[model samples]
Target: MKDVYGEAIFDFYKGDHSVVLTTHNTYGEPEEMPVEVFFRDHQDFTELENLAITSCEGKILDVGAGAGAHALFMQAFEMDVTALENSPGCIETLKHSGMEKMVNQDFYAYESKYDTLLFMMNGLGIAGKLASLPFFFSHCKKLLNSGGQIILDSSDISYLYEEGVAKPNHYFGEIQYQYEYKGKKGEWFDWLYVDSKSLVQETKELDLHTEILMTDEYDQYLARVTGF
Candidate 1:
């Protein structure tokens, strides 16, 4: 976690969620890892950052609103916004930030509908597992307002590969990663990188249409919510 805002700014200092948390290395060695933390300050973000997301104004739900940056952006646009995060510590921070609009509820249990579902920063992994797409859609659908939209930002590692050049027969994810934290090189980072068309194809099965909302070379999609 970065030390800017929201991730670590809890009002009442409390204990952590009791999950058997541990960080691992590419070698699969275990190292103790601390919880991620963040903090929010209106002064940290520039004016351009505010303008980027404000263009979409409606009842917005900012999922995985790390540090409340996007939440602040939506609030500036005068839109009704609700920020939900799974971390209890992150929630406590937002609660005391004096922001009444933020909520700590999990999306699985959230009952309200939203016109806009804004997700960024690995939020596409809300399903947690690849096969959980249907499960994710089932729970997340309950929160969509009529004619709603899902704006998800994720990276397409396929873009990282040059065209026509065959990728390694082995999974690129198998090339383990090294983490240098707590004065050690550790932690294997293996997570799926959804291809641009893969998510589009998958979403279509659920009767939704996805398009490249914005992409320079990196592929991001504005997954439009349609039938079902």
Candidate 2:
């Protein structure tokens, strides 16, 4: 996989704070993401993010911990936090940010037990497709300690389709994306945006219970999964 996303992050942390990362989505025009967003302080976090952070307990694994922002916040309260990132460049950035503990490994490939798995910024999209949720939850079950929870945020994205229009045969939330930075384009990857209802159903089948913790008008929501 192209490491363009991590390269941008490393550059921004190294004083190129003006860098902007662009993403080309399968269903929409390319979107620009500010590198600074990865470095947000606790006060700048959205209500959903703050809730996810506070809901965390015990040994916490910040999955896909891009720049270590969430992990750093948990560390402030002396929480046992470890950042798990795959990108070497982002790992370098995390080290420079003074993050105490981090693992440079892919989520599924890394084996560990955690009381809380934090997946902010739609981080659960790593599941790629709706069909992959079972495998995703099974892995979550393996990695989670007894009484552990998975705290995550995602968007419904159903509104992206017209009311009476014919939707695609595949799930609308299964989007393909590519990242671009400084004229470098990354490999395309699949990302998911499961609606709350479907998410609940999927987890239920795996004997996991999903709670809709909070939601906003934009169809974005925070959720917690337990009963693993």
Candidate 1's TM-score reads 0.65
Residue 203 in candidate 1, Cα distance off native in Å: 0.8
* lDDT score for residue 131 of model 2: 99
lDDT of 2 at 100: 96
lDDT of 1 by residue, 5-97 (tens): 222234222334332234453334565433332333555543333333653447788887765767865676577888887666567766655
Which residues of candidate 2, in runs, are more than 4 Å off? 163-166
lDDT of each: 0.57, 0.92
Candidate 2 residue pairs in backbone clash:
none
TM-score of each: 0.65, 0.96
Collision count for each candidate, in order:
11, 0
| Model 2 poorest ten-residue lDDT run | 159-168
